[model samples]
Each structure stands twice: as C-alpha cells, then as structure tokens.
Target: MKEALLLQVETYVVDLLNKQLAATNYYHNAIHTRRVVANIEELASLEACTEQETMALKLAAWFHDVGYIYTDQGHEEESVTIAISFLKQQEVPEDLLSLVEQLILATKSEFKPKHKLEAIIKDADCGHIASENFIEISGNLMKEINAKNHKHISEIEWLQQNLVFLKNHSFYSNSAKQLWQPKKEINQLEVQKKIDKLLAKEKKKDKSSRFGRGIETMFRVQLKNHIELSAIADTKANILLSVNAIIISVALSNLIPKLDSPSNLFLVYPTLILMLFSVASVVLSVLSTRPKISNVAITKEMIKEKKTNILFFGNFQKMSLQDFEWGIDYLMENEETLYNSLTKDLYYLGLVLNRKYKLLRITYTVFMFGIIISAAAFIYSYYVYFSV
Candidate 1:
C-alpha cells in the first residue's frame, strides 16, 4: 500500500510540475526533481535505510521542488504544506506524513538536517554539484536566474559565486561524503580553470582598450598642432602680401610719374628696381597662401586597398557623397587602416606647412634686399647730380 502511495505521489508531482512550472525554472524543473529522487534512492541503499525511511525520502524528493511551480521565495515551506495536504488525502499515518514534511523542508539550502533521514534527502537535492555535467548544469541555473530577474550575470561572476559556494558546502550524509567528495574536488578545479581563463581574457581586453585610447590622444594632439601651425603660416603670408601691396601702390602713385622727366632719369632705375622686387614679393606671398588642388581623384579601388585617406577633404572632395560615406565606413571598421590614414594626413599636412614657410621666408628676404638697394641707388643718383 505504501509503495502504491509513493507511485501516486511521483505521478502527481511530475504532472503538476510539467503543467505548472514556469519556463524560466531551468534548474529546478521536473528533470532536476527526478534526479534528486534517483540520488536519494542510491544514498538510502548505501546507508542501509529502513523501507519506511527510504519511502519517506523518495516522497519528499518528489515534492521538494513542486512549490517552485508557484514561486521561488519560501518555496520549501510551501512544498511542506503541499506534501502534508497530499499525504493526508492518501490516508497516510500522521507520523510518516510528518517525517515526509520534515524531509521536504530539510532540502532548503540553509536548513541543517537533524538526523540521517534528513541528511539523505538534503544530500540528494544538491547532488548535481558533484555530477560530471556540473558546468553545464550550473550554466543553466545562471541562465534561469538571469531570465527570472531580468539581469545579466557574466560567466566569470557566476563561476566565482559557484567557487565560493563549493568551498563552503559539504555533504551531510557520511555515505555521500565518501562517495562524491573526490568528484566534487574535480568540479572545483574545473570551475577554477574557467575562472582563470576568463580573468586572463578580461586583462588582455583592458590593456588593448587603454592602448587604443592612447593612440586617439596622440592623433588629436598632433592634428591640433598641425592646424595651428598652418594658421600661423597663413598669417605670415598675409603680412607679406599687405606689405608688398603697399610698396607697389606707393611707387605707382608717387615715384613712377616722376621717372618720365629727364632730370628724374637717374631715379628711374632705382624706382624700377624697387617696383620689380615688390611685384616679386607679392607673387611669392600669394603662392605661399594659395590652396593646393589635388587632381588625382580618389577611386573605390584605392579606398578598398586602404591607400587613400578619407578623413582629409582634399582627397575626397571631387567624389560623390555616397562614395565618400562608403569610404568613411570602410575606414572606421578597420583599426589599422584608420590609423594609417591619420598618419598620412599628418605627414602631408607637415609637407604643406614646410612649403608655405619656405615661400614666406623667400618673400621676406626679397622685400628686405629691395628696400636696402633702392635706398642706396637713390642716394648715389642724388650725389652725382648735385656734385656736377
């Protein structure tokens, strides 16, 4: 009669769990409960439990997680209530029904078992921690928690938590301790290995992130410096341009008309020399400030080869916006290509600055020499005319 009652309990709990358990209860589903039943049977046989004790254990295992169909919090107490109600309807004796309730409650993670029977059921409930598929099983539990709580728990974090639980936990039954302790140690090592690998990967990723930031900073600083220098070069060219323009205007308005007179013939050469140098200075200044137009159009082939810099407008100005956007996307996806393009941009900018500064230098030199020679020529022309 007791055997038939146990079978009824199993059938009822299995059906209830199948129909009512939430999909998110990945670790505490029907399979887990069935495994617990199997574990308790093996443990009971090894410990030489009486038929009554064994029957109570199997009944408790079947009902231990049924309350999870409704909720997870305080489910052990609910499980006990369900066990009592079911066993009473079966006309079970109060003594055996009470033992079944106690055994069900003993499976609570925080509960300390009072005797060998409680110990057997509790050990069975947590048997998977020593099982060969512990990692896969633990992963499912992690997934279940994340799904139910709507939060992410990384694998490394889950493994660390498992390691702490393993270090603190031990089987209550002597039979369980003797049979499963060695395998449990091996599972601990496996968890440690996984944790170590995850830590190493995180460390490498952090280092790479820092290095990438450093590269960005370098590019930012260098590009800013290049733009500033270019602006200064343009300013210098503008100054030379204004100065030479004024000199040419003054000569054309004040000096050139006087050169037509016979008495002013000596002044003609001096004035001509000044005018020629002023015009040359003006030309050089304009050249220094002029924008360089690139005739080489950026093609799709060059962009694909990573040969052209899409960041510089001069390189891509002639291309359609569609092509330019495609090039930009390609550049962004490739780290090496993006950095290379930036480096090339800086190098070309430096070259342009070098040419501008060189031209400005030559313009300043011409203006200075023109002023000195023209002044001396005027002095000589006046002395010859007056001494005669």
Candidate 2:
C-alpha cells in the first residue's frame, strides 16, 4: 500500500510537470525532474538513509522543481508550499510531510544543509555538474536561463560564469565529495580550456579586421546587390520568354492553317511575320536567361596574377582542390588581392546582368512592333480583298 501510494504521487508529479512546463523550459522539464529523482535514489542507497528518510527525500526531489512551472523567482519557497499541500492531501504523517518540505527548501543553492538527509538531497540535485555530461547539461541550463530571464549570454561569458560557480560550489555529502568532486574539477578545467581558445580566436579575428574591415564590408554589400540585380534580370527574361512562347503557339495553331487557302493568302505574310518575330524573341529570351558556363581552360599563372576569380565556380570548376586552396589562401592573406577579387566578381556580375537586360529589351521591342505591323497588314488586306 505504501509503495502504491508513492507511485501515485510520482505519476501525479510527472503528469503535472509535463503539462505545466513550457517548451522553453528546456532544462527544468520532466526529464530534469526525473534525473533528480534517480540521482537521489542512488545517493539514498550510498548514504544509508532509513526507509522513511529515503521516501521523504525522493518525494522532495520529485516536487522540488515543480514550482518552476508557476514562477521563476523564489521557486524554492513555492516548491516547499506545493510539497506541503500535496503531502497533506495524501494524508501523510505530519512529521514526514514537514521533512519533505525541508528537503525541498534545502535545494536552494544559498541554503546550507542542516542535516545529512538535506545534504544528500542537495548533492543529488546538482549531480549533473559532476557527471561526464556536465558540458551538455550546462548548455541546456544556460538556454533555460536565457528563456526564463530574457537574457542573452555569450559562450565566453557563460564559461566565465560557470568558472566562478564551480569555484565556489562544493559537494556537501561525503559520497559526492569522494566520487564527484574530482570529475567536477575536470569539467572546470575543460571549460577553462575552451574559454582560453575562444579568447585567442577573438583576438586573431580582431587583429585581422584592423586591416580590411571597411573594404570587406563594402565588397560584401556590393556583391549582395549585384546578386539581387542578377536575379531581377533573370526574372525579366523569363517573363519575355513565356510571353513570346504563348504568342508563337497561338500563331502556329490558329493563323498557320488559314494560310492553306488562297482566300486567306493575304494573311500568309502577316501570320508568317508574326510567328517569325515571336520565335526570334523567344530564342533571345532563352539566351538572356540561360546560365553561361566557361569552357576556357585556366592556368596557375592566371590565378597568380589575380586574373582568375576563385569566388565564381566557372573560374575554378576544373582546378584541383590543392591549387584552389592555395589560391584562396593567397587571396585571404593579401587584403588588396581579396578586395580586387571581390571587385572583379561584382564587376563581372554587373556585366552579365547588363547583357541579359539588353537582350530582354530588344525582345520586348520586337514583340511590340510585330503585333503593330501584323494588325496593320491584316486591316489593309481585308479592305483590299474583301471589303470592296
């Protein structure tokens, strides 16, 4: 009966947490609560707690973080309140209920444990910080903090914060001190190593930016604009292509058949002229939108002279990776060369877009003139051959 009652309480806590905890509570959801419960079970065995003490500690672990669903601030007190109310509903002994409330309260990082049981529960709650998965768990904790507090923390800042936290944090239970303390120290050292590497990388980037930051930004913006204009040119070409295709289709189906009869012979030249202009327009439109591939062979000398643009695939499509990497490295090391490459890339893109638009313009002009001349020819033929 006692086992069944405890099982009921665990079920209720799991259900409540799953329902109340938002998706943004990435660290404090049901998974975390379950982990704490499992940790306490392990510690309870090692600490040699009595059966009643074990039950109370396990109950506290299950309920301890439940109040995170209600509020982020002063959640420990809310957790204690919830544990008391739930235990009362279960008709638990007053002494056992009070002990459970105390265990929940002891989980607050600021609160020092007043007894062995309290110490065990507190250490269990923080078991992940000493486990092999500390780094992954710590990342989730930071994400949860950011979501709950509406704060953004950089990787370096978070590592520094953990450094301070681990420095000050201590395991209260002898079991944790003996087993987890060494692992916790290892985690702290790894975090420090990461922080150092990140700092060095940032320093290098800052130094590199000193030489060509403005030029790089200018080139990036120009390249982006050129790409946008190229897209617009392609879209215009496609529109002309579609329009001319439809015109040719209609001329072939409807107008070409009429030319078989001598009575409709006057329509022959006009229809043929209309279809000719449309087919020509379509061919030009397709050329304007067609992707051009380079068939010319490139040599290392061209790359050395900065005449080849490694940024464009057509320029380096046939080059070996080693050669390409060497060319890229040379460009990166030389700020002037990098800027010149970007300039050439942007300039060539502009040239291509200009050609596309020029072709599209001619296509539209021919289409317009063909329609006008065809309508004039049709009207003149009708008046001369049939109107009289």
Candidate 3:
C-alpha cells in the first residue's frame, strides 16, 4: 500500500514539474523540493514527531509549492486543491488528508499558523531566504522575471527589494537562525556591495590623498612580519624534527640492543635520558609551529589611552565601526603618535616571539647535547667494562 502511494506521488511530480516555469531554475527546481523535504525531516527529528505526523509533514512539504504549476499569483490555493484531489484518490485516511492540505495552506507567508507542524513547514519553505545562496537564488529569480516579461528593473528598485528582505526576513526555526543567519548577512552584503561598486567604479582623486604614508607603511610592515614569522616557524620545526630523528635512529640502531646485557646496565639511565629529551624536542617543535589565539584583540581604553594599535579590525570587531574609524582617523591625522603606537605594538609582539624562540632553542640544544653526551657515556662505560 505504501509502495503504491509513493509511486503515485512520484509519477504526479514527474508530469507536473515539466510544465512549470518555476521548475526551470534554482528557485523552484527538484533541488528546492529536495531541500524542503530535508528541512522537514530535520524539524521532525528536533520536534520528536510521530510516524503519522512525519508522513504528513513530508507530504505537505513536497506538495506545498506545486501551485507554481498553474500560476505564480495564487499558487498556494491551487496547490491545496490539487493536493486534496491527489490524496483522496490515493485513499490516504480522510483526517490525514485534510491535515496535509491545511499544512500546505499554512505555508503561504500571509497565513497565521495555528499549529507547530504548520509553522515548521512554513519556516522550511521560506528558510532559503536567509541562506548564503540567497543572493545567487535572487539573481536567478531576477533573470527569470526579466525573461518572462522582458522588463528590466531599475537599480534603485533592486536595492530596495534587497533591503526589505534583509531587514524583514526571519528564520522561524532555531537551527535555521543559528546556522543560516550569519551566511545570509554575507549574502545581503554582497548585493549591497555591488550597489556601492556601481557608483564608484573609477577613482577621480589621487591615491596619496585617500591613504596616509604611515597607514600604508603599517599595512606593509605587519603583513611582511606575518609572512616571515610563518616561514621561521616552519624552518624551526623542520630543524627540531631532523635533530630528533638522528638521535632516535642512533638510539634504536646502536643502543637499544645493548640494554639486555647485565654488564651494560650503567648505559641504561643515559640511553633513557637521550630518548626522553628527543621526544620532548619533537613535542615542543609541534607546539611552536601550532597557532595561538591572535594577539589582535585590544581594549578601547587602550585605544583611547593610545596604548592599543587601532590599525587592525580584529582589535575592534566588538566596537562600533564608526567609533573605531573616528579614533583611527584622529590617530592618522597625528602621524607622529600613530607611528609610536604601532612601534610599541610591534615591539611587544617581537618580545613574545623572542621568548618563544628562546624556549625552542633551549629544547633543541638540550636534545642534541643529551644525545651526544649519552653516546659518549655509553661507549666509555662499555670500554671500562671490557678493560676491567
């Protein structure tokens, strides 16, 4: 019975989709249907729905947008009429069939949902509006609209529509808001940026007027230091690993076998010390190259006090951009003071880097010395044993 019902549903979709303009692109293709089904399934898991509720949710979600097969204007109502007729023919229980149609109608954006299932399906349908793909999907919709009517919208109209959706749209499900909202903001910003770019495609003023000499220098010096530090870390790690490998090879190949001899017992402690130091060197090498939390964060008081470098955005990701930009612009006008602030920041960072390398140098030196001294100790003890 279930097999026959699923088969009928599939056959209906295959025939209906081909005639629909909405089914042509990313906006309303089989992919959209598949995504709706996926979201409904996730909502079911999160809501702990019953088997009947699950079936109803999945069916309603799949059939909700089928109204696009008729016309875009009032497809919601048309979809309900079609869904009811199809379910009745399938002989799904009468109560279950009515619930499916209700779920479909509730998905219409203007409808006030009266149940949790309705809300879930409604949220799932429009959930993509807050996705990273929102802009791309909107572009596809714009193309479809223009192709159908051959009407081109003004740039202002496009921007206003984008702002409305960005400001007004909300994800009903917690998961959608949490995971998709951040990406959606990025999507909105992309369109906003394109609008900004259209007005300022070419520069009319001198480059020197737009940016200060020291500000440009800060960018260059900071970037160069970052690259150099990365290379140094890599080189340090390779040196440490190579030194340890040589110690381990000598130990395993030469010294490990002599541990079984009662006469060579004095060699035990030194051999153990050598291996322990080698292992410690390798571990420290890994840590030195591993990243730590960026040192970019600085307090507002630090900026106001001229103690923090306001040159990096990571320093003020929590601050209002307007405030940070104001402070930075003020500092930029006072060129002498700004360079002093940057010099201090670089000096402190250099101090930290110095401490890290110092510790690393010690670890490598100890490992190398321990291996050589232990090797000599083992040979000396062996010679004494044989000479005696």
Clashing pairs in 2: none
RMSD of each: 10.8, 15.6, 21.8
Q: Residue 28 lDDT in model 2?
A: 83
Q: Candidate 2 lDDT, tens digit per residue, 294-320?
A: 876667688678787788898888888
Ranking by TM-score: 2, 1, 3
Cα lDDT of candidate 3 equals 0.73
Candidate 1, 300-331: lDDT as tens digits: 89987878887888889899999988888877
Candidate 2 regions off by >4 Å? 211-388
Model 3 scores worst on lDDT over the 10 consecutive residues at 199-208
User: Model 2 TM-score?
Assistant: 0.56
The superposed Cα distance between candidate 1 and the true structure at residue 336, in angstroms, equals 14
lDDT of each: 0.89, 0.85, 0.73
- Return the TM-score for candidate 3, rounded to 2 decimals: 0.47
- Count clashing pairs, candidate 3: 0
